[model samples]
Target: MSQTNDYPLSAVPQSARKGFWSTAFVLLGFTFFTSTMWAGGTLGTSFSFGELLWIILIGNLLLGSYAAGLAYVAYKTGLNSVLLGRYCFGEQGSKLADFVLGFTQIGWYAWGTATIAIILVKLLELPEAYTTPLMIVFGFGFCITAFIGYQALALLSKISVPAMLAFIGISIYQGSIDIGGLAQLSNISPTDSMPFAAAITMVFGTFVSGGTQATNWSRFAKSGRIAVVTTLLAFFIGNGLMVFVGAFGAMIYQQADIVDVLVAQGFILIAVLMLFANIWTTQDNTIYNFAAAGCNLLRTDKRRTITVVGAAIGTVLAVFGMYNMLIPFLILLGTFIPPIGAIIMADFWFKHRSNPPSLDKIKLPAFDACGLSAYAVGSAAAYFSPWIAPLVGIVVSASVYALLLYIRSAQPVAKPSAS
Candidate 1:
């Protein structure tokens, strides 16, 4: 299919025929080289051996299943998936969905820019004063690439993915030789007490909110089977690779920063390449989604909005002190993500009974106060609950929405008079 200047909103058959391997590679690149892994690096620095193992086992099981399940839903529901929230949130409720997704994308873009700045400063031994300017330059560069849209982003992924994978392979091979054996590396851990649950949350949180962006990529898949296969492959392989490298780093180096660990391992070139590649993949998607959300809310040209807003926000965050607050920012993403997934799944699967109406013919069903109430309650429950906020939020919201639908259906309708 030929590339177009306009943003393609619908899934055209011509665009959907990308080969399975190509799709798989793109998915793998995106998932593997994300900030979540960097966040996991921090987690690995704190968690004990047994606890980290438990987190990897349980968190991967749960989150990987969720990613596959949501991809299946997207396959069935199609392009206007987010708009299906009309059944629960009213006609305007979808805007709230857009805002949540958009705001998070902006945050991710800012974080990516900061990560690039951090990598460059450490790599070159630059002073603190140079970090902000470098970050702004990186941010602007990412915004320009993202403003070019999906095809450009896909090409970027193709180039970056192989280079990153090769670098990772080289690092692992060298690190294993230096450290004696793989078994010795596998047995080692951070030697500190970090909650297993927190580790699990970080793994799940990294990709859970990604459901919103699934359609953006999957819409181009040739079939539902392709989407399912590609998504499962990406989530499992990508996350597995991240944890594997994290474990290796933990076993060999005691440093808290992953870049430092890479440099110490004599893989400084690979370190810089991986860092840049990872940040670019993440920033592209982040800016793309932010622009899409703006178009949805304002009915404006995506190119204009994305370029202007992405550059403006990216520049501001790079200039200000936002990147310095990574943990708090990530925790905030963890908090609200489950609710959006809950609402999307509930609206598309249950209320519509697995058949969403045409996008052009969309109807705003009566506002489900019960559903909205459940979201509020669920969000609160997530905050208060000690062990499983994500699970609680999903259950509460779904149950509330289901109950409301049942009640409304049970009511008898008035009969019309015959002339």
Candidate 2:
């Protein structure tokens, strides 16, 4: 399944597999922003400083574990998440997962593009007429980066990651001074409070779906160990830093956005740099995933066309202000996505324990009744369960899938004997 030099298919081929650093950099760029800080801002407003630390740690640990396992399989299989879903959900049926993963990414892309567009307008004091074209420009610009494929995304990330960090460092230092230093802020207790369970859900819900789609980039890993270790490292450190920046900014300046904090502190140039770099890093990856998922749905390798179409669709949605009103959709995405990954892991462990067959080699069913049923059951539990909905979805789906597989395996094989 070799793809052209110009286009890597939705299901990436082995030839395009990247080294650990490249994979890590891209994953880090993907996991590094947009929601972590927002969730941290929410947490800071609700919980005490000590409580926030524990929640961030525990929540991210769960996320890291989830990503580590999925990343390894992606590295070994050389398939994106939607392609992996086909083995469990059926080639025709996987469009559901593709729709969910792809749709959500497009939503995020629109929101990010719109957000930056609005911010740029404010920064430059441009007329309102500029918003729509700005959305179109940024939308198409980001899409082009993704259309160029993983190599370009990784190269941009190499620069964006460090630039983002340098500014975050400066923000932390200035924010600390404003709050009378780290010792003072650390000692102050929170005025508002959130339930522990709700806080944990908030953390996971922020990126659980994106984390599940990690194979979109991580499949490029040179080895399973590199994939697992680097993926976990990115989730823990890259995402955790996002949370810390938000919490620090919120507590000190009553602001969640570091860019806002920089502007208030009169570092307008630095503020502009941070704002562009942060959103661009993630938005391009979002478009990349959109193209991958589109390729899966259309069963084609024309990634560039899909990228352009996705960017256009997202830009239109942003213009209409539709992307921001999709909190419920995002929540649904969190609940449903984890089970897909869980089923993939269970199928690999139970059915292909000794040797997992490649897509071309395996005799696959049209759809696995057990896998599809298990996913539905998991989604129901996630919606109804009081706590840790994503976790419940994973555990229930995996357990049900594994049990079905075990039952099938238990049927005795016929033996021929001499009488």
Candidate 3:
């Protein structure tokens, strides 16, 4: 296949790549920090102080391991994370993976767009009609940013990432001193208490696919070490910072909305910058993935089709006020995301024995009955299991796919006779 327009499909060589620390910084910037804090603050306000900490610690540990494992798999496999699902899912079965991933990207983009719109409206005291158009414009801008692809994204991240970190640091310093000491922080809680499991699920759900994205980004890294180190460092620093801020914010505001609390604390500038960076990086990465998946599905150039389609979808959703409802959207995302990760890991690590044919070399297979059945069973397991849906789904799907593949291979087939 010809290279897609403006998309960085080729891998970067180790000799030509930047140092690990620099790469780590870029990854941290790309991941950004505020979203986690925002999500955590939301969760913390709804849960007990001790419960919130347990969720963050446990959730990040699982998500971090999953992200690392998936990244390693993608590095060794040299395939797009979603494309790796083809081994188990078959060529057609992979489309289900694409749909789940693509829609989740769209949902996140819409949510971020709506969030920016609401913030701008509140900050400037703008009229509803004016703010609505602004939302569409901003949403379209996000699509365009992703259309420019990796280089532009890196540049944007470099600029916004530091600003976001500084803002968070300042906020933490202010909150710590103002809200008494660390011990007093736990005393503050939200009006509506959230369960610990639910909180952990929300945090894990946000980053479960994050590792999958790391694989895409890691393709750009110079070496496997660079890929591994950069990803881990980024998650620890960027994501860790967010969690800290979230915990602090929860202690201070006793509310779920971090932006509101930031404003109240007279850190409005920092709040705005953090919000913009969080949404911008997230939307850019998501649009790129959406476009890549769309291109793969259509057998076309991703850049040309993805930019046009993503922008239209993002704009329409923003105009319709679709993104504001985030909690429900996240809950829905939790349902299907685990299976995708499971299928990818199963295909790369077991089905292919860590080696799959090159993208150009392999011919697409017909829908695999075993893969689909596994997915069906896995989804049901996730829905029914109360603890760690992603973990449960992975075990259920991987075992089923492996067992069925074994059975299929063991059965003898008749040989065709030469005329």
Q: Point to the candidate with the largest TM-score.
A: 2
Q: Report the C-alpha displacement of residue 298, candidate 2, in angstroms.
A: 1.4
lDDT of 1 by residue, 49-128 (tens): 55666776666566566666566666665553344444567656666766777777777777778878877897989998
In candidate 1, where is summed lDDT lowest over 10 consecutive residues?
Answer: 1-10
- Estimate the lDDT of model 2: 0.80
> Candidate 1: lDDT of 27?
69
Number of the candidate with higher TM-score, 1 or 2: 2
- Give the lDDT of residue 26 in candidate 3: 53
Extract clashing residue pairs from model 3. Answer: 46-194
Prediction 3 TM-score vs. true: 0.90
Least accurate stretch of 10 residues (summed lDDT) in model 2? Answer: 1-10
Residue pairs that clash (backbone atoms under 3 angstroms), model 2: none
lDDT of predicted model 3: 0.68
lDDT of 3 by residue, 1-419 (tens): 23225333333333334456555655676566345666777776676667766777777666676666676665565556666666667777777877777777776666677778877788767887777787777888876667766667677877877777677667667777787766776776566676666676777776565555566566556556776767776665456556656766765766334566678788777677767777787777777777766765654565656766876787678678775566666565665677777767776766678777765577867687888888888888877888777677778987887788789889999889998
RMSD of 2: 3.0
lDDT tens digits, residue span 228-301, model 2: 98888888778877887888778888878788889888799998988888888898888888888888888887
Question: After aligning candidate 3 to the native by TM-score, how far in Å is the CA of 122 from where it should be?
Answer: 0.2
